[model samples]
Target: MTHLDDTESDDIGTLLGADGPFARELPNFAPRLAQQAMARAVQQAIAGRDTLIAEAGTGTGKTFAYLVPALLSGERVIISTGTKTLQDQLYFRDLPKVRSVLGARLKTALLKGRANYLCLYRLDQTVREGATFERTQAAQLATIRAWSARTRRGDRMELAEVPEESPLWPRVTSTPENCLGVECPFFEDCHVVKARREALEADVVVVNHHLLFADLALKQEGFGEILPGAAAFILDEAHQIPELAGQFFSQSISARQLTDMAKDVLTECTGITGAIGLLLEPVEALQDALRKLRLALEPLPTRGAFQLLEDRADVRASLHELRELLATLEELLASQAERSRGFANLRERAELFTERLERIVESHGDQDVRWYETFPRGFALYATPLDLAVPMRGLRERTHAAWIHTSATLSVAGNFDHFARQLGLDDPRTLSLGSPFDYARQGLCYLPPDLPDPNARDYTEQVIESVLPVLHASNGRAFLLFTSHRALRRAAELLQDKVPWPLFVQGTAPRPRLLEEFRASGHGVLLGAASFWEGVDVVGEALSVVVIDKLPFAAPDDPVLMARLAALEQSGINPFMGWQVPSAVIALKQGAGRLIRDVHDRGVLVLCDPRLTSKGYGRLFLASLPPMPRTRALADVQVFFANALSPDARDGGEGRAGV
Candidate 1:
């Protein structure tokens, strides 16, 4: 095997294109110009050590496009993905395949957020306390205990019997907040520390956006920094970076935080045997304060930003009481600093949490927005940045490396201005690689006319009515995607008795299982929210009709979005054009890209929102889509699917006969 020199890097075409090793190494490899082009661009970025943002359309083999270049560059690189699912795929499948193809001796490590790993300290504490559990959870914990005795990685994903959303997970895992760090008796055997050690020393590391932010924000637990040492960075699914970075930069404190801290202090006192008796009094007082705060805010609406919640007499009083109690707790914990190291760490965390809550409640940052997210159990107060550019600019300056942000949906109307501006990257070398799918021959963009505006009260019902016929034509191999829970529930209610196929909703099961069941059901109609729009791939005839209830827009009432929009308005910016439209366009592109996933696949994309046709901004959404044949008539959509469901599509024969 020969090491490719700088001159040989130009042969990226031969490597990715047909008649190259890809053809011989991969049985089903179909070369696309977009993939080859993107790979070369990535190679160039690494060679020059400059920032680049590339949008490779679907079927571009983007994982290889970036992975191949990064691996070949022989640089200490970190590739971050949007989700853990993709993270695993890159580590376990794509990276290995590409490395094998390159004959590269790459040292790779996969690191997830700390929450994914089991904390032996937490697990032992729970087990020793004889914590009560439901029968199923008890059995699950028993299985975990049995596995814990032998497992090396200690990743919760190894427990295939336990679902990812199981309530038992949080009990076993450690969050950054509750983590005892080096104070734990099991510190030497900690899995998170082990994983981070591997990532810190490896040639290539695969991480998720959350972990990347931890590195970029310099808040990672368990070890040394990961960002400054890496020679290059590649972010797959880069569209998720802005929102994820926003979360990391923001500060939040919640009733749950207080409860967790109190519980941890008490558990420490109880679990550590004859140590730290003085901490319990303040811990108990802290618990009482938390309860008082919860009771005070119980009467108010479940959620609102500080603007709405701060003025209420009961909430204000509760805030004052909680702040005073937290202060007292901090002082007490500080006094115990000399007695126990754990107490010292607790005091520092308490101080941080207290400071964070004050900042959130007071709206401390100049460009920050104060908001709240409500829940049935409790609510959280947040101080979120209105824009991530300032913080992102700081990260860019701190790290001198080639930063590549690549995704299939990073651009709107063939432009990267929205994404670049959000991330404070001015004049990055940008490229847009078109999809290889012949959308003109394989797909149809169905826009039904005379539908009500998406905001109207009758919108969900109208959408259901409009798509019922399309479902019939395709024999119910459809994905019904909604933008809101209210809309999803309404559509599910109306279509319950009408649709012939089995109906599947998002929350009914784990995401992977739902997709699996939907696929196995063959004609199942799965209705879901934003999660359903992206990261879903259903090839062949199982998914032939994609029905979008409305133009994909973030909720206007959402705390973060609302605050950002207001901030933009204050700055004399057109919030709608500058922020809202581009966001919606990117989301709509994700929803639309769900169809026609494979070369031979065929489907009809149903846009149920009338605003998509009536409003002027709709043109931007259309321009972002793969240029498929458009139709305004319902009969045309029905006919398109009718012809698609024929033997033509399955036989790999000519399609687009009806359209």
Candidate 2:
């Protein structure tokens, strides 16, 4: 119901112009045509209540592009990002700067999922059972209790003393199934309730994709309809939506859910007489069944269709036993449901798990794929729909709000059809704004010649050999992104004592710590896998080269991917060209984007996959990237780096071929 006046519409362009408020207030701000154009398009989309698909390349200042229009729109806005880290960045860093520069009067709030908040009721329960925890965990619990008395927001991120992966987190946090809602003794002062209440009243709310999709999928995360009634929904890093939508729509059951239910039942028994004797046998039986099933699945592939269970008689037997034991636990809990609210919740969880297991086991429809994935000591089963377009479109229509999807890599070969079809949009408003950064002058694309095929047995070794020269030329300030962990590990082993610069390897430390140390190590070579492909920003001379080991195609053995490809083929679509290629192209765009983050950033991108040259589809990948000059010879790369670091080069002199 909010509309922009003529002056306000003009102000979007003027405010983001060279003499805008940002240019005056911020020291590093520079105006770009692409950013202004994107702002106008977003403004129009919000005013007209239309869907807009925007692809703003890196350095386009897409965040500001959307934020300016959103803040100026004079309506309730919800901005959902790709990750929690980004959600924090927007809420803590970006929003404040823009709000200050514009002097906007809108109220804003940061809302995360229930797991991010501390559950006071659950914390009290854990305190009562402190004797059962290890010495370190008990100490961690004491720390959390002390912090709980003084922390205002109660966000777990506020407590850096406790590591994120600490087991104590689950003991203190409440999931939707365990939360008693208004029935809890601490409902009046609950943090999740307070956060949601603030979001309901704020003019703008910042959330991650998981919370946004959880609302759309109607998944119970303690609160209800936290995102509804917003006039605009701006999805940043929108390229991650299609795949994430599938995850939200899927019906899943996991070993952790079952184990947690058993643990909760035992915790509940502490308050009720005779409850322990009644539930002890069934709880132990269910735990044993879960362990047996995991052991049975250990012999199969880590992930595959549910049909894999049919071929293994032992696995089938174990699954059947697990299901039966779950039913017994549910029935026993039902008898004690009348005793307490906690018992009633436990009964419902047991019943839900039993029904989910039955549905997953019985699912044989062609429209959905029933798949199972195994971890080191756990497993999860899912029945995921083949297409998310119908449900996603339905959700959008129901919202009756403007939808703006923007990211750096939403298009393939200058086309948006692949991304649009995934989201079920039909010729929606489209805008493609290239990055204002001078890619041609600031970067070089080096496809190393004489490299073996990516599928060859010695491909990893060859890739390490090929990138060593590039590393030497750049002084090893590089990120070597691989398609899989096996290759990353191999590269790390090969580069260990062979290079003069320090090496940073994934899995050795937390992602944030690794990035921090890598940035400090001026000449460090970091080896990483999928997680490093996107949402990573490293600007300046610290990161000068990015070497991709292979084309980032989804593994063919993935159960959901295999099913989706088959469905596409049945619909007369070229699964390889239409689905796989476009997906890989978007992924490659993200990988290549790391090389040039700022206007002054100059680096070489080395793609070690020979398939990019040997195959016809290579053209699509090449055309989608930034317009960096391409080279096939190693000498060009050497010269590009040598001249790039020279003082003369810094003073506008050039020795590189493309330059």
Candidate 2, residues 232-269, lDDT tens digits: the string is: 99999999999999999999999999999999999899
Q: Once superposed on the true structure, which residue ranges of model 1 sit more than 4 Å away at CA? A: 1-9, 222-224, 271-281, 299-302, 338-341, 363-365, 645-659
Worst 10 residues of 2 by lDDT: 650-659
Deviation of model 1 at 521, angstroms = 0.3
Per-model TM-score, in order, reads: 0.94, 0.97
Give per-residue CA lDDT, model 1, range 1-659, as digits (tens): 12347656668877987888888898788888889888988888887778899998888889989988888888899999988888888899888889888899988999988889988987887788898888999998999899899999998878899888888788889877677787878999999989988887899999888888876774755444755678789999999888889888878888887888777667656545444566777777777776777777776666666777777887788788788888888887777666655667777879988898777777656688787776777668887788889999888778778899999999989999999999999789999998898888888888877787677888888888778888888889899999998899888899899977999998888789999999999899999998888988888778888988888777766777877887889999999999999999999889888888888788899888777767799889888989999998878776776665456555564533434
In order of listing, the candidates' clash counts read 0, 0
TM for candidate 2 is 0.97
Worst 10 residues of 1 by lDDT: 650-659
- What are the root-mean-square deviations of the candidates from the true structure over C-alphas? 3.0, 2.4
